[model samples]
Target: MMAKIKEFILLKIVIPIVDMMMGMKISYWYKKINKLNSLSRDKITEWQNRQFRDLIRFAYEHTVYYKEIIDKSGYSIDDFTSTDDICRLPVLTKEIIRQRYSDIVPDNITKIPHRKHSTGGSTGEPLRFIIDENTWGYVTAAKIHAWKTTGFHYGEPFLSFGSSSLFRVNKKNRLHDIYYKLRNAIALNGMNMEDSICRKYIEIARKKRVKYIYGYASSIYILASYVKKHNVKYKLNAVFTTSEVLTPEYRQVIEEAFDSKVMDCYGAHDGGITAFEIERGSYFVGYNTFCEVENPLEISTLYCSNLIDFAFPMLRYEVGDAVVMDNTANTHYNGQIIKKIEGRTGDIIRLKNGHTITNPGFTVVFKQFNVKAYRIKQLSESSLVVTLVVLPNFKKEEESKIIDTIKKYAGDDCEIRVEYIDQFEPLENGKRRFIMSK
Candidate 1:
């Protein structure tokens, strides 16, 4: 009752004024997204065909790298009449994005309202990119639309377990405090999901009547396991898991604990792909991304083309995930369908003192450095080795900062060592694993 009243005021009144002040029309995009969600399958596909052609033409004219690639491939921009023509271009890998970052971005970037962003380094290789405000607004709208499928209304309280570096509030910012309060969000540090912390989160959720939970799959699974163990009495409308693989076992446990559906969401932000599970075993891919499957027999890789992001367009970008594609008709949505996503399977690292560091947690400190790739191996519970493949701009002093930041999580008594390497040896599975233990 209270939540509905707050939602009415916040969404209708507060949000518009905030949008007007900030010069961002996320609400406008949100309304458009709701309309897009109701479009017919054929109409959505037609829209995608047009958007893809425009994006390709824009990339060829604005970006140096795409112009060279298209020219060298003996293909003209006019040839991209349909979305299928994207297969002709070479796949844009993480290495290409890193080496040719400047050439890939447009010359008129200074005039755009974009922010510097980095991937969570789930694959042990983080790619930094730019996302304009337009793209940001669309993504936010799409996310809210996805949440609404689970009967979640905006302005309702929710619990988020994520990286402390990203979600933790700045003590000095009163506005941020007010924003979280108004939004009714409680963010707990996912890196340290100890039993005590998990218990406190459950208490807060029970007290606040938070019907939604969102965060990394492994972190949520850990909390779910604790809930099931203690026989905690909690019921939620939905559990939204992202940023990591949602295993069958994890899904069963989470759904059983919450007595609700677990909505799995996938987003390759750099490549601008987003999908949300609307039903069991059926994921609805968003209209803004044209997803293509490569080598699909049992498992396959995904190549995503961002149809909306014109400022920094990633045409046919390799997302580096193995997924199962559903060939069934798009009965649930106007867009494409994915059967299951085999995302980055994150592992939990336990310290000698019983503290834990979750997947992509260490990736936070590496973002401040110019390190290209990194791996953390636990030689013993107390001793650790960090191997890094750094770029030319990587400074020597950044090494100590990595050690200090890690020790803050792993503990002050933990023995840490850092190693620099040209590259990592190829794995048998052909995937990079960052968190490992001997």
Candidate 2:
């Protein structure tokens, strides 16, 4: 009864204000998904099968890009009855998105405003994709559902160190600034953080009694290192890490520092792969996202088919992450468990000013550049070598702007060398590490 009262006042009341102000109608999606999460395994499977069929048929009929691929392949949409037959179709890659950019989107996307997105260029070349109302509507809904996995109740505050685009404090938006505070969520600059900022981070966390902390594994690991060294304590309920790979060592440091469990999360830019850690080596994949493991013996890429994203069908989309699994989860599949997440890991770099930051954090600097791909490496204590594969349409002036952004974080004394390249060298496993520090 007390929980219900808390839910009514905090979730139903305060969260609704976020819905009203932001106009995302997040509460509607949140409530709907909460009930669906309680359904039987058989029921969820039945719904997923239906959704899979609907998505494949819709894509084959509507989108020209899917049409060519389906027509070329001997298999019909009828063959894909479940996850069993999705492999009959060829794996879709980021290269396909680049080739068939215009034709890949549904023809009726103009019916409502479409949101544009791009990958972080971590996996490979960053490819721009479009998400219509359905994509915007359901993906955020699934994310809210994923939040439950972090032990976060609806109304509790979260101090997020997310992508600079969303987290940056925009002084121009006065109304939004007020609403941001009221939502009990605060966004801190993860990219350019130093000891002074990290100290403020712990201070705010302690003062607000923030229930959760969200950031990239490396970014939080840096903060965790700080907290452990100083022995600062905050009433932290959980630490949520995402973006880069969450190794066991990083998890140990972060959890110990915050005096809370670290919950690792995985999601893709294409709105397909969504998962949150349930136990150390197990993650419960979101109900809306049906996943099939590809190359199980090797890199173990996840083919995510988003049931809710009809505006852009993500049928068997290869979200860039490698993994291993086991039959330990009884609820979702027959004990199907994600035993490990084998993504990229690198050391954080110390700037000339004696401040340290995650090397992957530098990816934010290259966001404005229309480069096809990039990789950053710490050459020495105060030097970085950035290799970029520029797109045909990229401008020269953007190069200067990117350099300025890097220097803003690393300081002017950091020996910076920008190398324009036709292509970047991939690792032995064929995946590129976005950041490398010796």
Q: Write the per-residue lDDT of candidate 1 for residues 1-438, one digit (tens) a residue.
A: 877788777667766665564434668878877887788978887888998888888888889999999999988778888887989999998889989999989988877667778875446767779886677767777887788778888778888877653544454345434544777767767776767778988999988888999887878888898899999989899999888778899899998988989999888778777888888878787778888887655678888888888668888888888677777676557778888786676567777776666775666657777888888888887888999999898999999998997787678888999999998884554667777765
Q: What is the TM-score of each candidate against the true structure?
A: 0.90, 0.88
In model 1, the runs with Cα more than 4 Å from the true position are 18-24, 120-122, 164-181, 393-397
Report the C-alpha displacement of residue 171, candidate 1, in angstroms.
12
Q: Rate the local accuracy (lDDT) of all candidates.
A: 0.79, 0.70
The CA lDDT at 320 in model 1 is: 82
Positional deviation of 6 in candidate 2, in angstroms?
Answer: 7.2
In model 2, the Cα lDDT at residue 409 comes to 69
RMSD (Cα, Å) of model 2: 3.3
